[model samples]
Target: MNPVATWRRLLAELLGTALLVTAVVGSGIMAATLSPDDVGLQLLQNSIATAFALGALILTFGPVSGAHFNPVVSAADWFLGRRTGTGLSLRDLAGYTVAQTIGAIAGSVLANLMFDLAAVDISAKTRTGTHLWLGEVVATTGLLLLIFALARSGRAAVAPAAVGAYIGAAYWFTSSTSFANPAVSIGRAFTDTFAGISPGSLPGFIAAQLIGLALGVGLLLALYPDVAAAAEKVVIPAERAARRQRAASRR
Candidate 1:
């Protein structure tokens, strides 16, 4: 319940997400442009690049933040008893989401500037396609499962590396090559560039991911009976700031 611990976790997640989004979107774009001959192979290469970047980030910040740069992972961790215990309040959610959004936008912006990427409209996501939807399902489920297993055995120390490897493997198995983070998925929608999913198809793809995440949680519950002890409640943005103000006032 320490304030310092909360702050450190917040900062760590922000840093990790910033690095993650940049590596994911940036490398993805580069691969697509550099190897337009084979879209599938380019995407696979990009996935490997993302994995390595993520692995490095985790090793750097995992101890400080548990390196849960994704909301899903953080929420899952809280559900499974891995939260830092200052309490995963709405304040945490607000802080985390704000940072994540900024990081995603900035990452996309940087990628655009660096690679001459086109500005894709928000509504363009509709073309994500059925294959992408299937990919999201498989990728997200695999990601969550990897996180759950690594975290459960106190092997969380190596979570970043383990997570990166899962992603690399998932890329080969899934057709869409995995857009696991919702924020990143939405951000990628803005670029009509090589990595953008069709805005119209975003909903279906996201839905599949949500279902996959649910299934993953169910599997973990059965496999690791103690996982629920880590569940963290989703904090509504507006409510969290007020709660923090009140807590500070009390102090």
Candidate 2:
């Protein structure tokens, strides 16, 4: 891809991630405000809003940067595609991760400002414990498995809905409420709202997510030895935009 194309991809990752975090944090705040006494109702509202917004974001940005929005997803793409040379290069991976992280932080700050809260209100909700860590592991593992499995099956078209659905379900099933993305985990630390995760709990949650990434790779390899062929198209057809750019340039 040309330099311009590369920059476009990075920009898509940044904006897509920013919007995703905005939906997460903003919806959480809205839910809390609407259902102050009913925590369960708040969670339901948050999850539903997040799921719908996530699916829409993926559809919007998938063709550009694969809609990764998460460092773990980008890392997994690199790891799985390294041998076959079909996925993101090391440089691209680094760029995507950085963009996603910055976007996450920016989104959180924006959400806080929207709610009339301090821009850097650090989370006080302490989420720790081995059980919670286990939940993170499971949530991350399941997320990767779902994404890669869809790729391997040549079903990337459904990934937007599938991923959104999985995350929405994970929120209810997992003890940690499925903060499966490292970038998201870090972003939520900036808010004291219902979706926030305390900074102190970040290390353990991130570690578990990394571990889950490894286990997910192992499982994918075992289940589909030829999965490398689809590694570049994890959440969607990442090359579609590039192909369009190349074609337009030729004309």
Each prediction's TM-score versus the true structure: 0.78, 0.93
Model 1 gets an lDDT of 0.66
Q: Write the per-residue lDDT of candidate 2 for residues 110-181, one digit (tens) a residue.
A: 999999999999999999999999999999999999998887665677889999999999989999999899
Instruction: Give the 10-residue window scoring lowest on summed lDDT in candidate 2.
Output: 235-244
Candidate 1: tens digits of C-alpha lDDT, residues 1-251: 32336666777777777677778777877887788899777877788888899899877765555566666665555455445443355566567666665666666666676776554334253455677787887788778888767644545546667889988787678887777776666667666666666666767877887877777887888888866433322221223333555685799
Candidate 1, residue 187: the lDDT equals 64
Whole-model lDDT per candidate: 0.66, 0.88
Candidate 1 residue spans exceeding 4 A from truth: 1-8, 82-87, 118-126, 229-251
Q: Which candidate is the best by lDDT?
A: 2
